[model samples]
Target: MIYNKRLILAHFWLAFALFGVAILLGEWQMFIRSPLHGWLRNADLYYRSVTAHGTVMGYVFPTLVAMGFGYFISEAALGQPLVGRRWAWAGYYMIIVGSVAAVVPVAMGLDSVLYTFYPPMIGNAFYYIGVVLVVVGSWVWVALMGINLYVWKRAHPGAPVPLAMFANVAGAYLWGWTAVGAALELLFQILPVALGFATTINAGLSRVLFSWTLHAIVYFWLMPAYIAFYTIVPRAIGGRLYSDSMARISFALFLVFAMPIGIHHLFADPEVGAGFKVVHSIFTAMVAVPTLLTVFTICASVEIAARLRGGKGLFGWVKALPWANPQMLALALSFVMLGFGGAGGLINMSYQLDSTIHNTQWVTGHFHLIFGGAIVIMYFALAYDLWPHLTGRALLNLRLVHWQLWLWFIGMIVLTFPWHYAGLLGMPRRMAFYDYTAPGMFAEGVSVVMSTIGGAMLVVSAALFLTVLIRNHSAARVDPEPFTFSRAVHEPVSLPWALNGLGLWLGLMIALTITNYGYPIVQLIMTPEGRVPPVFVGGKP
Candidate 1:
């Protein structure tokens, strides 16, 4: 099926362009905080850069990439032109304009609330509005995905939806519902206070609402990578998916389990009781099951491919596998990093262990590894794999792609490992300066130096990534095979509605969310005295 290549390329290029900018901002942030760069210390500038870096990387880049990738998969994997191309373009522009609107305030030092925008620390009203617009734009995508799937189902009757498109739409559905928490918080709580219509804002309540979106949003960013693992990587490596049913079950589990777990992030906060925290922590552990399933499934698929290539013993298949293939290498490295990240997450989810590292650099390292390291390496692989197909031009250099992936892997390890160590050694997060000259600060200085070096390596890797894309775009056109997804080992002839449909999962998510968050939120709403007046950073208000 022919896709609108221009549309796909436009979204992808914009996403990566922002990623390149965020990479530089991230390095600058680490540099200014280090002891050696004390002369460059400016708290205002550092926080602003941190806000912009986190916003771009956490919200803008991944969402755009997922949306763009979804559109491509809708057409390529499902063999149909997108049902709402005009709407998709509108969404693209909305995201671009919204990102600009949000970013301008941060750049001007008017809004440095950071990506989470925890209130009663408020920013300019436009920042909140800008974020709402981005979510609104994504909602457009969510609607379009549903429409396309509905239309496809009606057209093809009982035929099973393509697994890639099915999973993509499931992610869209999940985001549609999950984003409502943050959206409502902005509309009801943050916006009114930011605009000065309300003097007092409920900080605890805002945190609760944002938490609804926060943890689940990671799954939103992660789904595309998971989509690639189940649908694209297997085929790329000459293997079939181990189980279509397992893939469906994992995605379903994510939709149901990923949302209610956000309260685990609030274990340190006083607004919520221990009961709610324990409930959320248990759900947080539940979320890990799907990830484990994915790891096992993907590994099994790779093993099948390796065995076909002639492997004798139990682990000989690992050696026989295609180590040089960029996608294969990325998958292996992503899994390794994910293991490290997951172990840290286990600590965070434990009520007892969380206090040890809460608000420390350990939390920062864990998320960066999972989101920036494990998830984004797959994004890099996707770009390399898809660019040629979308542009009808061969990649300028495969060697450059390989080098970029390895550098990214190495850089992330160097960057995050020290953070984990230093976090244990009592390094606080979100601080602009570390005071290395102070008593008992020598060990912290060593970690800071290590982080700065890693940050530099990451910037180098980012440059190489952009170079590969630019060179690929300018390369001579060449014919390549149509991009295809792998079939499951046991092809799904007919799926139960529970497995194939979204309604059952969506209802369960709503019920679970209400059961978990309803009481605490209602309690806060009833008590006006609990609300606190806004405090504007940088003396703006």
Candidate 2:
């Protein structure tokens, strides 16, 4: 029943608004990659678009969603108002300013390093400063989540944190750790070169540092979606959560294992040794642990709902459940994409298999399916579920909402499936053009062009989604009951501190990251690596 209408609406609106823009940019980039008139055939514009597209998608949109959704969880799950209202507003404005500052430089072709740190190829100073501001703003939100949780615990000393809130804080801390590597690189190395304080940077070290942030950041984006899975989806399906304790363990496991596994991203890079890469690959596989746990728990919860509704016999429950409900449909679709994406990811975790697809379209397809298809479907569902509560407007028309979801799901599969095929056919990524007439490239040429149709489908889906949200304002209003999360079959009343509080997990996560990253980072710094001079983007010839 706790609702902070303006506060919640502000955060959600900004996040999705930027998401809309990023989607348009993404489709254009897709077209550019296609043989469809070569998408204007300008490399400068293409790289600019890539940087803008990646930055917003990777940093601005996801971070804001997490932050906004974190605020919503704080108030709703805790049965209290948020403690740091002014600070939250301050953080939002910082992100807004930073997003503009960061993206403007990208659009001007002055910061075309393309999202990840490629430090020996420095971009504009404003670009790095802008990103730093966004990170700092997110850090403020992280502090607020901690403060809110502590305040709640003080009032109810022995209680288990609500599952949603627990997951929220878990993600906050996870991101807090994840941002450090990027922050260090920008502060010490990239910024120095950009501002003319230093002329050379160790490119290997930049890649290593960015690798630390790279993979874990995906889990951070996935956090809100996963939160929707455990906390909201079961309730939407009219089922109680099967096991609250299991949910807690999954989130905790992600916190412990997600950060260390970033090394697996460096598997093809020479900066890290074979032993460390092997260790990281082993640890990276641990991600599947929590993922499997989640799959089991959610599927069980859905089965319970089906049986309660008088679903009879094996698999009949699937029919009894409400596929018409957007939340239900989104969960089913999200899981479908997750299956394909996760399987593709398993290839990357293997050192030899990873080498086969490194910097190829296959990796791009895997990323898009996982994040765009699986993760983003739930973001849509979460937004639909919360909009009514925030605006006191009834949810959008079921038909339109369902159609939007279906289009995105189908379009994503159509788009990414081809990328995987083209990649296997020796197609490289980040190119603005491809010669379709080249011998033996017929299949690859066909793949990229066909994917453009998928891109167009996604763009249409995005438009429909925005329409659904905007149309809700003029639609009839209802007196909404304050929203609620699902019940656990046995409510988590008193739980172990390790499951409820982040204190133990935080310490353990730090130790794991240090063990994984410490030696390579220090070696790259202390020893002489071949340092390269800055090639500033859009600089003088």
Clash-forming residue pairs, model 2: none
Query: Residue-pair clashes per candidate, as listed?
Result: 0, 0
- The parts of candidate 1 lying over 4 Å away from their true place are 39-41
The superposed Cα distance between candidate 2 and the true structure at residue 128, in angstroms, equals 0.8
Name the regions of candidate 2 deviating beyond 4 angstroms: 39-41
Give the per-residue Cα lDDT of candidate 1 at 349. Answer: 92
Candidate 2: worst-modelled 10 consecutive residues by lDDT: 33-42
**Candidate 2, 43-124: lDDT as tens digits:** 7888888888889889988899899899999999998899989999999999989988998888888888889957688888
lDDT values of the candidates?
0.89, 0.89
Itemize residue pairs with steric clashes in candidate 1. Answer: none
